[model samples]
Target: MSREIVAGVDGSPESLAAADWAAREARRRRLPLRLVHAWRWEPLEIPLEQDRPSQERTADDVLRKAESTIAERHPGLPLTAEVLQDTPVAALLSTEERAEMLVIGSRGYGAVAGFLLGSYGQQIIAGAHRPVVAVRSRDGAGGGDPEGGVVVVGQLGSADDGAPALGFAFETAAARGASVRAVRAWSLPPLYAYSPTSSALARADEAGGLVPYEEQALREALAPWRERFPEVRVTEHVEIGSAGQVLLGSSGDARLLVVGRRARRGVIGSRIGSVAHAALHLAPCPVVVVPHE
Candidate 1:
């Protein structure tokens, strides 16, 4: 099958931005883009006086409108649209068997006032079968911009598991002619556990030792990348906090946040790692969750 990118739409500005991002990605890769609009008639029944034309209140109409908007705003892109009579999360999951990547807006029209993202966006990222790209409002697509092409690849403690992530990151960075900021985060156990003589009195020493070790870990992770892509500019960040937060905090200037999805059945399972799950919802920019298989 041809490469396919599926993006959710809800008539919100955030969703529109997602459509734009997905369209640019699809065009870049020469892949077909599938625009999805999932809607349902909740409460099943409406008061006779409140009921309007079924065409005006149906999911199909909403989807058609979205398709028209896309045609207007994103012309000359290979695209298709679908309106599903189901929840947004379920609708996206239904297309998992064939989609190369599933994209969704951070929030929708149904989102609560003053909230940046809705619950559906979070749920889909944590449980998607394929890679899930959570497109944030701040991620606007424009050509010839001098923005960073940095992509953060979240490692789940294994070099082999991180291969696809690094590959994707490197290619994206290369395409944009920007540097790759490879980051790794780890937390160390208390020094007292390793040394009976070590105590709070040696707190300064304990802190000093951790810096080198963190740097070494990050260096080892990027060793192969440096050898393989000597032409690509690579910067390493060794963080000492939650992986999700550090990655999210740095994503503001990133072109994309690449993460590995963990699975149990085959080479990859249906579940995404905890850190990848969190970053999808809270990332300052677009996040791409790469499946192991």
Candidate 2:
């Protein structure tokens, strides 16, 4: 059952865009696509019978239209439509265990202040065990970079700490016949930088004394992936800066931006990592947050 990619749809243009993106990825991965429309039955004033059926019809219509849209774009993509009588977040998270990943529409800066993020949407993204892709599209613009653009992926900590993100990026690039831009952001040790000791001065003479080590670590981190996806041309970027800012800068015109998150919640506590948060809000391309150990 985990061979399928589940996409949440609510008939909104953004959700439709997400369904399209998921369909494209499903086809690329040679997997099935499942579109789920979830809505809770909560009647404030109207009668339960009157409000319930209307919302149910709306849900059916949304799934039907999504299926049509995906079928038209991705012919013969092995698609299925489902309707769930539950909250969006709970419904999607429930399906994550049976799917490879969950794709959901997210409001970007283009949307009203970029502050329209639903608290529940963020919950599902942070709580899911598998990877979750938050998509914001303009007329389905990201069909893959026409000029074989890069797939920017953040390499966190050691090579294995962020293996899931790296592997997902490489596989996606290979599918699109595109290259990968692996970025590793590091800062000089504060204790070593400001100390007025002879050791600090000597190390500073060699161009920060940390760039080469960071470069080597990044290389080692990407080596196994490079071997696994030999056809995915890789360009290593070892920059000295904040992870979020560095990733945002390198995401220009990228087909997809891949980032890592720990399953046990990030520094923000019960939310996505700072880098992933920044990326989902600011990145111009589709962003996938891969959960790792």
- Evaluate all candidate structures by whole-model CA lDDT and list the values in order: 0.69, 0.82
Model 2 clash tally, residue pairs: 0
Q: In candidate 2, what residue range of length 10 has the lowest lDDT sum?
A: 139-148
- Candidates' TM-scores? 0.74, 0.87
Residues 113-209, candidate 2: write the lDDT tens digits. 3324467668987898888888775624346324367899999787888899999999889987889999999877766456656563455455456
Counted clashes in each candidate structure? 2, 0
20-64: candidate 1 lDDT, tens digit per residue: 777777766667888888866555464554443574467566667
